[model samples]
Target: MIRGVLEMGAAGFLPKTASPEIMMGALRIVLSGGVYVPAQAIASGSEMVLDRLTERQRAVLRLALKGMPNKLIGRELGLSEGTVKSHLSAAFRTMDVRNRTEALYAIAKSGARI
Candidate 1:
């Protein structure tokens, strides 16, 4: 896992043995635009695949990640509802995910910056 983290150029690697303070620090780093890798890969057993998105797709996903509704996202991005849906579908396809929950898991597990 450490090897993968280093190879992926992630921001941090934390072992389960780390203290609560250290874990919190890792979360803070991740929240502040950094990556955090655990002692092992995610139990979901998937490789980090955050690099697979286009810029637009990444933007949409970021809004989605913030728990925005499709309508709100459309309004904020100056897009139509249908276009938002289209972008969402394309983003899901690009991430190979079936739904928002799965996409969120992938994003968190991958430590995706977008």
Candidate 2:
């Protein structure tokens, strides 16, 4: 009841077991400047499943995807190999992944590849 009240306070309304017709009605109400959510719905948890990353992390992911060795990537980016490693490590953490392959895969899936 508290949750329902909270949602209602936010200007949204919904039924726990709405039929198709009720769903359409809710949509129409929402379209007319209301917010709609199912009663069973709760606030979304973990908006960011992955940690935020820096530009360097994004750069490292891009370079890794191009099959660039760390050393070469460092040279191209005008960074030291150790710096490249640091960026990649951060990228791995931000992507919630391990290893270059996983980082690359995550980047691709996230449409962050350059």
Candidate 3:
């Protein structure tokens, strides 16, 4: 339900446990066209997750954040295209996002530097 609301541009995804005041504020923010996802939806303390990334995954994500294609990223990292895809799959799972773009969004939203 929360995910559906968020995807529909409802602006916020708060747990039912949120205070009334918090809900009101979230509603206002949503009305103003701002996005608000609950902390759970984002991997907060994401620097820890960042640190947990393998060196290759970090490199791959950084390049991906720059909009680099897999082929180019592989070339730069001296990894095969298959290896790059494998790394991307692992990264997507770790980041809890389905795709590269969502991964970047999740990482930034979690307050990670990159």
What C-alpha lDDT values do all the predictions have?
0.67, 0.58, 0.69
Candidate 1: C-alpha lDDT: 0.67
lDDT for model 3 comes to: 0.69
Query: Candidate 1, residues 1-114: lDDT per residue as tens digits?
Result: 554554465555678788998799677756655455442443333445556677777787677655566788899999988888898898898889876546655665675456
Question: On TM-score, who's better, 1 or 3?
Answer: 3
Q: Candidate 2's error at 76, in angstroms? A: 0.5
Q: Where does candidate 2 stray beyond 4 Å?
A: 1-51, 111-114
Candidate with maximal TM-score: 3
Per-residue alpha-carbon lDDT of model 2 for 25-77, expressed as tens digits? 66764565444444234223332423477767767756654446778889999
Q: What is the lDDT of residue 63 in candidate 3?
A: 70
Lowest lDDT sum, 10 consecutive residues, model 1, at: 38-47
TM-score to native of every candidate shown: 0.56, 0.50, 0.58
Residue-pair clashes per candidate: 0, 0, 0
**Which has the greatest lDDT?**
3
| Global Cα lDDT for candidate 2 | 0.58
